[model samples]
Target chain A: MKIKTDKIKKISKSSFTIYGMVIMAYVIMQILVSTGSLSSLMEGLLVPLCIYVILAVSLNLTVGILGELSLGHAGFMCVGAFTGAFFSVATVDLITIPLLRFGIAIILGALAAAVFGIILGIPVLRLRGDYLAIVTLAFGEIIKNFVNVIYIGTDKNGFHFSMKDAVALKLEEGGKVIINGAQGITGTPNDSTFTIGIILIIIILFVILNLVNSRAGRAIMAIRDNRIAAESIGINITKYKLMAFTISASMAGVAGVLYAHNLSTLTALPKNFGYNMSIMILVFVVLGGIGNVGGSIIAAVLLTLLPELLRGLNDYRMLIYAIVLIVMMIFNSSPKAIELREKYSLKRLFTKKTKGEDA
Target chain B: MALLDVKNLGISFGGLRAVDSFHIEVEKGQLYGLIGPNGAGKTTVFNMLTGVYQPGDGKITLDGNDITGKRTIDINRAGIARTFQNIRLFKELTVMDNVKVGLHEHYKYSTIAGILRLPSYYKKEKEMNEKALELLKVFDLDKEKDFLASNLPYGKQRKLEIARALATNPKLLLLDEPAAGMNPNETKELMDTIRFVRDEFDMTILLIEHDMKLVAGICEKLTVLNFGQVLAEGNTAEVLKNPQVITAYLGE
Candidate 1:
């Protein structure tokens, strides 16, 4: 019991440290903004940094913790982005308060993506390893391509969805097209702010961290390690796998909500919601160290900020990024490096402090 | 009634008869052994009893309820917990967490409750920690509760698997070669642990072991299988002395 409490203390302390670091970063950024010390490049990247961090964290749940490689993360993000943007656009006048509208939209985005998650997870999660990865890759592209041709308009009759161009909508006078196919939703309320994004980050962290230490989390990890042993112990394999996959998708949706509101035009672009984007988030999870929550946050922030930070060194930008990626991968995963990390872990400092008091 | 009664349990792997006409009756609080050569289908019978493979024919009764061909998870929930011949610990999970997973069916809390950290989550988790710690102590694994399951030594890993099995609070515990890789000292200690688990937990155990000494040491009843057929069944002393059983083991 005593040792268990110590373990609990260690886990909670790590969670607190992560929370503290994020808050510290938020304060530093706020100060930078107030003092006008931040460049335009950084100011533009603030909300995006939050978006990538959320994406990295959510993908880590699938790729890192759940032990499944998923390439459809950006697709779930796209689902959330479209649904949230559409909600905000449709209710522009109805919801005069931007905060209220965005909040509702975030919830709606999560639900929509969760539904899609269950739909995809049921059939696809049954296939393991590279097969699941391939299927999710296909899904990411399929969603992007399908949303590219989806044109939805709102008129007195009702919502009209068409695969053809906007002209096929045939809207009445004063009626407008909400989703202009590949062009995506426009006039979405610019409701996203750094504070909202940070708040969402904290909420997402709270949910995922708590889930990791819970009974359900144990069951999920057990399934990841050994399916037959897990089954022998009476864990419902399908239920927990779907739970992890669906939750991961919904969190990606929430990240999408933040992303959609930040942009003036939310489109299903190849750049934003494509195969490359999913793999980008996955890179963050992997290079961060799979299953390391704080590592994910750090990797995401550093990787996202690297290109812009090196804007002055245009020719050397990607060269520097690739080198940094290699360094991080080695530090996060190499056995010798792992040993070094453990040797100098923060727990050592904590234990030393306690030992001093004991002496 | 026997705590576990498997009658004529059999399974075929395509054209091959892996196990045929296998039967065992383990009364409450009994230590039973199923001994056979490597290819004698001992593990196959263990698999069928624990629902790892659906029996091609026969009935499995636990207490009084028929549990034949139930899903592995359902069989575990029905009071049958097992360990594998090859250790299948959740290698990544901490040792205590492995046992806590075994306590999953008994403890109740929704995933939402877990994510939200409701009071019930705290209450149930605390209960689980206490119970898991107790099980670990039984196998002298309490000190290593925080270590990863994969990091434990081979002998302790076997004991940890049994500890995990006992956490499910099952009526019957199945151990597959619990002493497979143990040295003599570890095996002797293991015999004590096995007997203690059976007595303390009031567990009815069925084990598959190639070690004749372990088979004769603790198991009160013995069943001998060779080429998918039971060659002998009776009290441990008599079964071990049976000419056919001796011939099967010695290949005479």
Candidate 2:
């Protein structure tokens, strides 16, 4: 019984460390914002920061944990964003309570993205390495283009969806066009709060951290480390891969929901949910340390806020950001850094000293 | 009846018969060895049995059930687990995590339970860790439980692989070159460990090895393959003494 508790304690210790850091950062920021110490620009960046953190963490589950290269994460996010925004708009009159409406929209959005995950994962997961990455990249572009031309409106009869022209959908009296082709969804309720975003991040961390330490997570990691050995040990590779991918997509969908609600109008522009967005999320996972969930959160928050914080640099903001990214990549992956990390790890710091000790 | 029966198992890669007309019948609790020179297609036979490769010619029966051409994971769940010729431990994971991966199918909690950290999740996770620790202790690897699998010494890594294979609770275990890169003393220890595993677990084991001394020390029965076909089969000493086996080991 003691051993059992000890085992559980070990798992929770790592989780608490990460969760603690995130909570501390959250509290400090909240205090700063409330005390009027933080600038308005920094205050406005909070929701975007949370959304990127969620994306980085979710993408890490695939790229870092599962050891698969996925470049369609923003595609899943777009699915969630459009679906969530559409739901909020269509039900704006029926759902008087903003929180309840936002809640249902997020859930529906996550379900829609998960469905897309399954649809894409069935064929895409079969490809390995660069092929998989390319296919997913293509998938993101496809989704962005598809949503750009989509038109949806609601009236007394019901919802009308048209692919080509918004004018083709002749509606009844008092009908409101929710989604105008190329113009995006208008009048989405801005129900997302800093508190709600924090709550969602906590939820995402809970789900992802628990999954990473679970039995299924082990199977998925085994598949990543060695597929043949995993299969020979009775791990169903396809099943576990699909499970991780779908859950990752759903989490990104949650981020999408947050993003949709935080804005009065949500667009599927190339600049918003495009290939670059996917690559940016991947950069967060890579720079944060792959498979390191806590690292991802820190990286996401810092990277998201870096540009705004560097407003004085103006033209050099992006240049500095690029240099910082390159330097971080080198420091994170170089052999010397790895050795240093091994020597000075938190585990070693807290534990007893053994032989081969060098300062 | 035989616990595992394979008859006329054959596979060809690009018209080259990697393994052909292979046949073996292993009874429960038997320690069987398959020996051959380099490129004798010994590993191919193991692959075929574990469903890594579909045998084009024959049927495999595991205790009266036909499992030919089934998926690899299904074959394992049907009571066969394997180690690799090249150690394939989850290198980045801790030794305990490497073993816990083998206990995957044993956990009964739902995905939702795992995500939510419900009581059942904690219960099963604890059980798995405890069980994994016990297996590590058997191989004397409990002290290194937290060490990364890739950081272990080569011999310990080999032992960890066997320990992990055993964690699957398999009725039939396939070990491919478990003693590769080991000194003679380590190989002897591995022989004793194999013997202990068989007697203690009461499980059948099929091993592919080139180490004649280790094979003679532990294996009761032996089969020699050459050019993807069986060269001889009998008692380990008798098969080792066969001219065909000797010639296969040496040049023409």
Candidate 3:
């Protein structure tokens, strides 16, 4: 007898569609770049675009799927960036192969960020709504300042750490300083390429999509939809919340690693890994349709490129950007638009048509 | 031994004793009713039993196991599952997915198996879907399985909540105000559904309701509370006729 596996099949089918879209977009962009039709600006934007996509998707796991507001997502990213970049820098002389070193760095970076995720999540997850958001916002600022005060140097005597000042380290002969307070990590190997970014995006998408379609994902969503109901139904709230939060943070760390390597010099600045950055990622999730993973990818890519593409507009760029955001928000959520969307949704396209037909 | 027993279950918010020294003992396959006027601590008792609120003083035993002050999820796993007074269906999820959430604990596969979509995960998920569908069919919600929970009609939403709770396979089901806002017809239907559920599952059921007809129709036993204290307890006919219970409902 043929057992009904319709849910699994449906999930796999939608997942395939998302995967196909990502790969198709990547292939088309690759072709354009290889054909020299894409401008250098657009070319440079590719890696950042991929990074933002990962950031948006990961943050969506918390903000959308988990239904918890968090503003410290970039703090996790900062952890990943600095730790991954540091690994790369420290091993630059030790490991000759860039690919292998970067692979190790990415894993280490994700682990570091996940650790921070757990630490912050345990205390902060206990808080709800605006309180959670505020605490996470504070956490981001704390990490930024904490990274600023931290100073690391290396020499034949081994690594030295000092928070007061870099000079207090008293390094041995030929000692090299990696992190200079405020100046951030400089002279790191720029090993991040668009291909690597695409690979990471695919990995992130694979994990997230599979997770969302899985049992744990449903439990997490159940918690999001109705915490009391979820609890009464025997779902372990803390376990699912922490699971999604840590995974979300780890993915953000992966993005951070990609972002760090992509840059010639990386810093834990407010503009780079701060409140504004966190808000931007949140905006991606919101504008994309909360809990809509595929929408997040599109939103991240489009939003990332919008400002760069509007460079010709100069002074009016941000004004136009704000207008577009307002327009998209209205279009995405307005009742009439939603009605139209549901009526013409892709699922409706495939199902047997019954509307407007007599039985 | 009773299938479920509660003694001295009490909680206070500041100076107010919301539920003071409340107690009930329910036998297997019995349909029990907890009735009280608004704010008489009927729902509060359900909250404590389900562990939403830790009773300042009380002991809850299920099948002779102490479950007092346990976390809500642990209490549920320990054979007590409940529904909210207000329907709490996962609004964004499909009706099928909502039921599957209740069946999550029953799936034996590891999370790694789920993420990787191992053969075991598919097998378990298929079983889960079939079981969820079967529960949905029981409530006549099978046809609407793919619809979002929020999109269901108000009456169906209430039914879906009960169906979802039942998916947890609890030995003792605690339903808070299941017939709260239903019309006469819907309430009548709900009464029948509750009866069918008890007979089919052979489970003990505890329900809080202001609907006197529903309470009197199905409950084999009744506990009436007023001012955070039990006003009367006996067979349904006897409790419903108690002077204090009548005064509490009709006022002095």
Candidate 4:
């Protein structure tokens, strides 16, 4: 029966075209880079560019799909990065022990990030839009600050701030050793490459895409559009919002891990995980068009490379950014774009229909 | 037995009783219309029935199942569907997508399956799409399947809301002022559509409407409220002629 069903499906065709297209895109990207036509700046931006695309798209699941604005998205990313980085460093010496060490670390990092996402999502999700955003923003700041105060090792006054020494101190403090205060965890193993980062980003992107198209996702969108109506229709608004938040944060965590391993250092500083980074990531979504995954990726990659392209005009770069954003917002928000898009699509649709009938 | 039974359902906001000792019992397959002047607590009764507010005192039952004080979603899951007076749609989504949302309960594929694009997810998704399209077609909305809901005109938007509610396969559909802003022609068309939906879906309906002619035309039974209490309840024609309902509407 299964064989017969499979055969029948193959005969009619399916969305195999989408998968084929995805493969073609990857091939095209690789070819562009390898042929040197993509430019060094664009190439250098690709890895972080891909990661940000995943982050922005995933955040959209919370902000757009779930219809709840989140301002502390980077906090989840931080959790993933630190966890992934810690695992990689701890298992660097065990590289000769086959895939067990590296593989385990990646899985552990992703899981740790997911767990933290759940923990953080539960409390703040009760609040409405602006309140939720503010709470999440505060939570991110708190997490960064908390990491800063972690005392990893003690120097020489009987105990010091050190990862090496924390192993022993943990035994006495009942496994409560601090990593170190504000110094950031140094000597992190640099194991993340473009391949792994891109792969994980793809995985996260696929997850987010699926979620937004799911029953749960539709419920979230309904709440965003009309909360009262959604409630009247029997959608568990709170549950779905929290689910979106947690899933988004988990994806951010995966990106964080990739970021930490790529950067080869963890700085428990406000500057590293600041509000600026959060806004920069959000700009990708807004510029790309909210609830649009493809647009988000395009925007992330383009925006990531924009600064590099304007590196020569460093003094006036920010001013240019502001102007571009303002212009885009003015054009995007007005009914003109919507009207134009509708007309264009309608025209195209009729033309296609007429052509098909004529043939 | 009453399909929806509400007893002593009252809600107080600070000093005033917004809805006081409101009571209603709607039988199966009943086309019940609730009418009242502004602040007469018609909508408040609907709210309490659907779990928007926990009544100061009340009990509600559906099919002999006690569902008092359940969350809105929980009450909905128990086979009650409702539409707002102000048409509420997923504005950014397509009309077909909006209908698909109402068919959410049927999609059983997990998030993992959906993300991985597993065969089951694909199959379920295909089925869902078909169902959504079918729903749109039922309401003459198939032509506007891809149009963003907010772009739909007023009358069509109202039709879309009813279509969406019916997609839930509800046992009892509640429409809160479905014809508030509609023209006479639209209302006439709507009266026909409401009857068609009720007969086709074999569902009971509770509607809150202010238009006496429209209410008297379609609703088999009527419940009139005045100042948070049931002023009149009987067959539509009989109840409309009642002195209490007349006095309440005339501000006597």
Task: List TM-scores for all candidates, in order.
Answer: 0.95, 0.96, 0.95, 0.87
Model 1 interface RMSD, one decimal: 6.5
Q: Give the poorly placed runs of model 3, Cα more than 4 Å off.
A: A1-3, A314-317, A347-359
Cα lDDT tens digits, model 3, A194-306, are 89998999888888887887899999999999888998898888888999999999999999999899986888989889898998898888878788888888888888887
Docking class of 4: acceptable
Candidate 3 DockQ score? 0.55
Per-residue C-alpha lDDT of model 4 across residues B159-203, encoded as one tens digit per residue:
899888887777889999989898999889889888888887788
Docking class of 2: medium
Q: Which stretches of candidate 1 lie above 4 Å from their native place?
A: A1-4, A312-333, A346-359
Rank the models by DockQ, top first. Answer: 2, 3, 1, 4
Compose the digit string of candidate 2's lDDT tens values, residues A25-75.
889999998899997888888889999999999999998888889998999
Better of 2 and 4 by DockQ: 2
* Candidate with more favorable, higher DockQ: 3 or 4: 3
Question: For residues B1-252, what per-residue lDDT tens digits would candidate 1 score against the true structure?
Answer: 888888988899999999998888989989999998879999888888888888999999999999999999999999999999999999988888999999999998999998887888878888998999989998999988877787788988999999988888888999999999889999999999999988888889999998888888999999899999988998999999899888887877
For model 1 the TM-score comes to 0.95
Rank order (by lDDT, best first):
1, 3, 2, 4
What is the RMSD of candidate 4?
5.3
Q: Which number leads on DockQ?
A: 2
- CA error at residue A342 for candidate 2, angstroms: 0.9
Who wins the lDDT comparison?
1
